[model samples]
Target: MTMRSILKSWVERYFSDEEALILLVVLVAGFAAIIWFGRMLAPFFTALVLAFLLQGVVSALTRRRVPHLLAVIMVFLAFVSVLLTLAFILMPLIWNQLVGLVQETPRMFASGQGWLDQLQERFPNIVTPDQMQSWIGVAGREISQLGQRALTLSLTSLGNVMSLIIYLVLVPILVFFMLKDREALVGFTLSLLPQKRTLLTRIWHEMDRQIANYIRGKSIEIVIVGTVAYITFAFFGLPYTALLAVLVGFSVLVPYIGAAVATIPVAAVAGFHFGISEQFVYVLVAYGVLQALDGNVLAPVLFSETNNIHPVSIIVAVLFFGGIWGFWGVFFAIPLATLLKALVYAWPRGLEGRQTSQVPPLKQD
Candidate 1:
């Protein structure tokens, strides 16, 4: 056969193969590269999340006959106002708690040591009082060293601070443009795609719906959890209820394990005042009940019919990202997973070969 005929035969054989293993490998590698790049640009990802969240508010205002520019300004101003109000209400309480904790640290340590001694006497096989004291001292020194290193690193990064300010300034500018011209921007992007992939437009809309629902529902859940936490703490006469509630609210931003982590410090502090057996139990019960309510009631009510990610997937994502990138990773894991799922569901094969559901069309503004 001629060289041209042989080449045609080879091309036909390659195209006829159903596996496409090499193509799959290339696609996976490209995806990994994108995820690595995204991880490196974590702050930008955060800004994008903030933008998506504010986009809805901007759209709502414009739907009420407000101009896009005015809506953007109003939403931004409202966000700033809420932050300022929260700061005004909670900062003093936090400062007072910090001051009190500082003054009482030594006494608290002494009390803890005494408790250790009692425990040691009750169970001689466990750690002795002297060993416990030595361990505490070592821990204190290590924590001090860590703090000093962190402070030094912060002071050395004056340039980072300036860059952060620039990024903050640019975020609102980007957000404003995105909110005002979102439809145009999306249309432009979709236009760049091949005509064969027109179905992807529906997928994109579905992804947007998932993200928006998740954000709105999570916000409502966080507020509910925070309110419940504050009320419960206040009812039990826990100190720094406002501060702890704030911590709880922020922790709820993370998916599975956050509530447990947030409960630890609060329970420890309360234990110092009310003794571990009594106060710790109360705090534990309160937190457990709150978590139950959140998981069983609030989550179902708010996030029903939304993204149905598995608990195992949530835990693995949290551990993987949290291990690699610390707190921000854990906090963003769900949204990132949701975005990936949406993209996967958009693929030609569809999500795990299941028929993809259509998202409701975007309503006119």
Candidate 2:
């Protein structure tokens, strides 16, 4: 027999079904171990994500004849400036509102109790006042307990806070190196793969392209939503317009659930302060219009050009990742899912009957 046939026969004979199952179990356990031990790597992963997102800006600067180091510095400075500007502009507004809310908590609590009393009165047969009070007491105690624990944790995590500061300081440094040596990194990573898996390298590059496009497209969509939200809120004379606009914009980064989550607080505040009739209706209508515009217009225009992911797939990805990693997972769900899709699209089963093409020569650094 030929060497290839002999090797295949030996593999088939030695690798039994039991061995395959054992290997599968081993892989699953290894993955679990990695995930369990991965928390310390979160900051690095976060930095990597940021670097990937800012790569376009770095590339643009480089294309403009800027030196790589200067390009990295400019991009980093621009990002920091924008963040600082937003903080300077919006922190005071949010802080003032938050302080007002805290000061008025007693009155709000009274109002809530009054509403509960009215509900008990209306449904005396179904829900007794005593039962309602018991429920409220339990809820209050739980909230208080949770708040205390959260406060304690925050106070105890000063070192964590310092670590975060260090991470932030290091991010730009890491990003600079990544941007400057991106091509070299790509080449090195690709070289690590066996020659037989060169196609996988090409697939990975395509996946990267998709990821970059998704990031750029989503950013543009966020800006559009934010601008529209700001305009609408300004027109409606909403309090904290800038802050609310920003909330809406940032929330858009989370997809469908994000819009609803953002709208809830705004709607509740408007309704509670201004009554549930006119102001509530106006805010609801405004958000409804914005959602419609986002779903039917902005998303299609932006995502259709690059990401053709199905809505159901997006939802599944959100559910899966959100369940696994909480908020951060949800934040990255779509990009991750898109990368997976690209990989699957390039898999052997996915590429059956596809024609081979001439491989391009690697560009010299």
Candidate 3:
């Protein structure tokens, strides 16, 4: 076949199906909207996600014949309670720990410098004075920059406080309404689409369960992992336990990348405070154990096979979405990738096969 004929055949083979054409258009439009208005629509999207996450519990309650309003109220109350706890209690603790870590910056640098100096004295040829001085200079510059950035961040946070307040107020309200009107909203959405939406229905059926399970499971994983990390760090008397624990907990969002990145701060704090002491070793061991359990045990139980995304696909999604939408992008990367995968595989082919199948076979006279 000619190139033009091949192109025509391919289009007819797929886009000729009205359902496939409509799905393709909807997907493209949705993807474009997210890319274009992501930051502007963050709170709405956040509320939508939270409602979906809480829907499972809401469903369970309804199944037991609990009033829908009561179920929504109960779930909303619980969500508000958790949000307030994090904001007023956990956040303050983490903030204090961060302040302490920032204050201890000089001591960490001095300890590191002293260690480097000792190495230079003990191995003059391997760690020459010039090399040590050059290394220290670079380190000093980096430390200075870090401090400046931290100071700038603190100043800007006051401004962000307004935005934070807006989110806190807006998201809950949006979530409550979304939860309360879910059925109406779903019906209205369906009304906007074609009635014969087999492919769309199939994809939604699959994605709905998977996405809910994923969001809820991830929330649980973060809490469990963060709590474990805090307890372990506190038991080992490591500095900045709250702050580091929060990082460790949220790190699970990006799978492999999060755990690896979180290790740096934990190890750095332990090393700077205790040098090569038994305490450092103990802290190290405890941290390793926590990560091991999270990956090998907690993850399997909580996530099950919900997120069967490939590791490579996950990393690429993280990098791509993260670049576009920052942290939220990274957080939702796996699910979005899975959604894309589902769309691609579930997309209907053209009517050629059906037409061929319906045609009568040649009669043998």
Candidate 4:
């Protein structure tokens, strides 16, 4: 019951076995490596993730009697085709729409300024005209600064173009080899671990299967939601449909935060296009419905296996991991959180079995 005794008990309860200590050291080392060299090895990590993502498809193909190398070729070619389509076709269109959106943004702000000015006059007690004008001035300044920053980035993109080209060339080659030699790679990795690794194996299997499902489900959700958004926007004749739809699609990456952030641009575009009209209301309604269905229905269907996480835990994971790894962190937040939960819940040193053995039998009397 003493503090020293309690401390000894706690350590024994968790780290009584060498395996537990080994697992702890491994986790710490992996995390340290990422923090130290994540950026330098980003392409390697990215390719690893892509290969893992596409491995399921490759396996399916091979299972159907397709040769392993041939299956790799088929999947790799399909992946390259999509990449080319996005880079050459979809990207240019989205870029143009994005440029147009940026160009029109000033006019949208002006219109919003006028509306707010009127609202100020009509509701003097709630909002004074001076306060409204100040707010608009602040917004206009922010818009101007944003445009300047974007212009600066475009001008500097030339310097980064070589790095981009390297990524384009290197990632695919890496992914192909990874797919072609997955078994060898996995074997090499496993050979590094000690023979008695049941806990490690359990954790790997749990993380691997769930992470794949989570990632694939998310990718499908993005495509489905984005396509639907594009259609809805186009049907209503909304401008920047591709750009907006893409934003809406990528928004699913960040859970609650992404959805809310995406709504701002969609609503702004809708308001600027329809100007306090019924069509504007309808567009907002449609967007809301889409988000509702995505959260309540489509996501459930695609990601049923990975939905054990709580909303609050998700947001915290997004914030925490996002701070550490930015976009990729946000993208993998749920999976990482799940991994952490698995680690915490896993019993080390046969502790669960030991606890069960220690339990007394229930009396029938």
Best by TM-score: 4
Q: After superposition, how far is residue 326 of candidate 2 from its true place, in Å?
A: 2.8
Give the lowest summed-lDDT range of ten residues in model 1.
Answer: 14-23
Residue-wise lDDT of candidate 3 within 1-365, one digit each (tens)? Answer: 79999999888877877888888889899879888997899899999988988999999999999999999999999999999998899888988888788878878888989988988889898877988999899988998888888889889899999889999999999999999999999999999999877777888887887777778889999999999888888887877888998999999999899988998888889999789799888988888889999999998998786858889999999999889888888878888898878866666432444556779999999
Worst 10 residues of 3 by lDDT: 346-355
Write down the TM-score of every candidate.
0.72, 0.73, 0.91, 0.94
Q: In model 2, what lDDT does residue 84 have?
A: 62
**Residue range 107-169, candidate 1, lDDT tens digits:** 666777677778888998888667877888886676566556655754676667666566556
Q: What is the lDDT of candidate 1?
A: 0.71
What is each predicted model's overall lDDT from 0 to 1? 0.71, 0.71, 0.87, 0.90
Candidate 3, residue 81: Cα displacement in angstroms equals: 0.9
TM-score of 4: 0.94
Once model 1 is optimally superposed onto the true structure by TM-score, how far is the C-alpha of residue 332 displaced, in angstroms?
3.0
Predicted candidate 3, C-alpha RMSD: 2.6
Question: What does candidate 4's lDDT look like per residue over 1-365, in tens digits?
Answer: 89999999899888886777778889999888888899999999999989988999999998999999999999999999998888789988987887788788899998988888778778889987678778888999999998888788777977998898888899999999999989999999889888977677788888988899998999999999999999999999998999999999999999888989999999999999999999999999999999999999999999888739899999999999999999899999999999998887875535566567779989998
**In angstroms, how far off is 307's CA in candidate 2?**
3.8
- Candidate with best lDDT: 4
Cα error, candidate 3, residue 157 (Å): 2.1
Give RMSD (Å) of candidate 4 vs. truth. Answer: 2.8
Error at 226, model 1, angstroms:
2.7
